[model samples]
Target chain A: MPRISKSDVVNSTLAFITLILFWFLGFWLSHYIALPAALLGLLLLFMGLLCLGRVPKPLEYVSQFCLRHLSLFFIPPLVAAWFYAEQLGNNLWLFLFAIMFSTFISLYLTSWLGQRFFGHSNQSVSQDDES
Target chain B: MTKVNTVDWQSIIQLVSIEQLLWITITLFAYGLAIWIYKYFAHNILFHPIVVGAILIGCIGVVSATPLQDYLIFVRPINWMLGPVTVALAIPLYQQIRLIYAAGSKGLLVIIIGGCVAPLLAIGWLFLFDFSDPVKLSVLTKSITTPLAVDTTNIIGGIPELAAGVVVITGILGVMFSKIIFKLTRCDDSRAQGLALGTVSHAIGTARAHQIGAKTGAFSTMALCVNGILTAIVLPLVFMLFG
Candidate 1:
């Protein structure tokens, strides 16, 4: 009984087409151009969004969509790692050490510095609440 | 005349086989259709179309015995665009200059500490565990986004492609879980949230932070840019020293 909003149709269609178009464009650029496809994909995304107007809700929906499903995009690449399994197999110990070690280090350092820089000292609290 | 022409007709027919052409067309059409279907069902979660399409393509590649490298040749064109897109991130950094200025020395200090510390921690931990050179190099760049991570890895004598993989994984994990970690730790302020997300997750984390609030996004963007530059300079130097 309700009429379809023109804006909704346009936005949804744009959203749907943009992803495929960008994917193909990224593939084409990566193959022919000397640039990385992810960078180009992002550039086209920004430009496309700009041209699509400042409709906050649709844009928000699109971004949320991207965030939630970020992992799906990388599945192909991850599976590609299977092809290199032989090489990785030989270097299994090294890979394990690297992933574990680096993850811990990044986690610790970020948490520590994050605490120090943004950490709430008594002075910061008093200064803020004093005003 | 027919008998004379028949002598070469076989070779001509083989050169333009309908079956082979039809197969190629079908593959291309299938890929397009899969992507379209993925986009339609994304529904703003882990089911996003790009992710689904990637999974489908990957499964197809495995099932068909297609060499991942050959498929990459097709995907590489899209992958190459990562550079300019990174440069474009600078626009947001420029826009947030006023906030950066407002936070002033304190903000600069926070960025500096985060930028310098994150890579150091990753590299140092890898070394302590005695990881191989390539793996070490890959992990060193994990705190950044894919494009920059690849470039940084290449410059630092690591495998760029491998680095890209690590960067993607790191980003996914960071984006998905950092918020829960933050909430658990009771880090509720925008500044702290931005710093934590940016420091641990990199660009994707920053995108997540942006969703929380403007200040958080601004700070997260700053963290991404500053950390990127710092890691670019510092990681290579550290690698030279220990690597």
Candidate 2:
């Protein structure tokens, strides 16, 4: 099994604090624009990382933990959606049609595009790396 | 008839005020049960974590006569953390910058087309159904990951909850049908398969893609981050201009 790199308590806590601070920064920016605070936080952090030209070890370590358990976080929202279930149910066919049809189309289009445009080239590059 | 009438959903409203701890335990346990099921079964699509956990929790609520509002009081903290986690998504995105650059204009073009056109197609497909403007707007963000989709949906005057629900559906359905879609489209390349999964299905798609292979997972994650960030950036700006 591959080793899991665990950050110490201090680094993880510091990383959490940094993320909260960035979230606050993004929240503040949202008031001046028509966007979500978290997304602005994401964009700001993305730019910051681009400037640094590297992801900090602590941030990467901590974020992976958060992302791994991301599904658990969503359970409440889905359950709470019971209140709106009536509306969703009424439009169930429309919802399913749009969601399934569009998703299939996009997946099909993207896979075809990716294969047609970059398949051979990417394969060659990986082959070179292996050699 | 008297027993049935007296035991209806409304009666529970006055019967008891359940503690938050109980609900939290139930939520966590449901999630644990889902993990156990996956470990034993080696199946994913039919039993996606969110679907399983949420359904179990919802079932518990119904049996306990607890409304979703009360359940929310217990799990609101989890929902609130989504914001910080959204910020964390940038970490993986940052890690991918080099790979994306190395992959060049071709990768960029694929991500851009997949990300942009997929959501638009959803909205176009919505034209067949006569939803309100706000309902129609919600579909715009459904192709992205949930947090970004919810946030973007809110900013664009759509229902954030609806956006989130559809995002999950998109993820599950995208993975569920990917095999057939790829074959029909003649997209035999593994890398492209991963990219399509991540680009259209978001997180759930990435998880399924990872199950396929590590290289596929990497490309899927790459597509996920780029598509998520791109939609989050562009959708809001486009709505701002429209208004």
lDDT for each residue of candidate 2 in B58-143, tens digit (9 for 90 to 100): 88888989877777877666677889998998887877666676667877788888887877887887777777787788778777
**What value does the lDDT take at residue A116 in candidate 2?**
89
Instruction: Put down candidate 1 lDDT per residue, B89-200, tens digits, no spaces.
Output: 4345444545556556766666666555555666676666645687666667777766567766776777666666666556656655565566555666677667666766
- Give candidate 1's TM-score: 0.61
Q: Quick one: best DockQ, which candidate?
A: 2
RMSD of each: 9.0, 8.4
For residue B158, what is the lDDT in candidate 2? 86
Docking class of 1: incorrect
Worst 10 residues of 1 chain B by lDDT: B43-52
- TM-score of chain B only, all predictions? 0.73, 0.88
Q: Which ranges of candidate 2 are over 4 A from the true structure? A: A1-7, A127-131, B1-18
lDDT of model 2, residue B143: 72
DockQ of each: 0.16, 0.48
All candidates: TM-score: 0.61, 0.88
Candidate with the greatest lDDT versus the true structure: 2
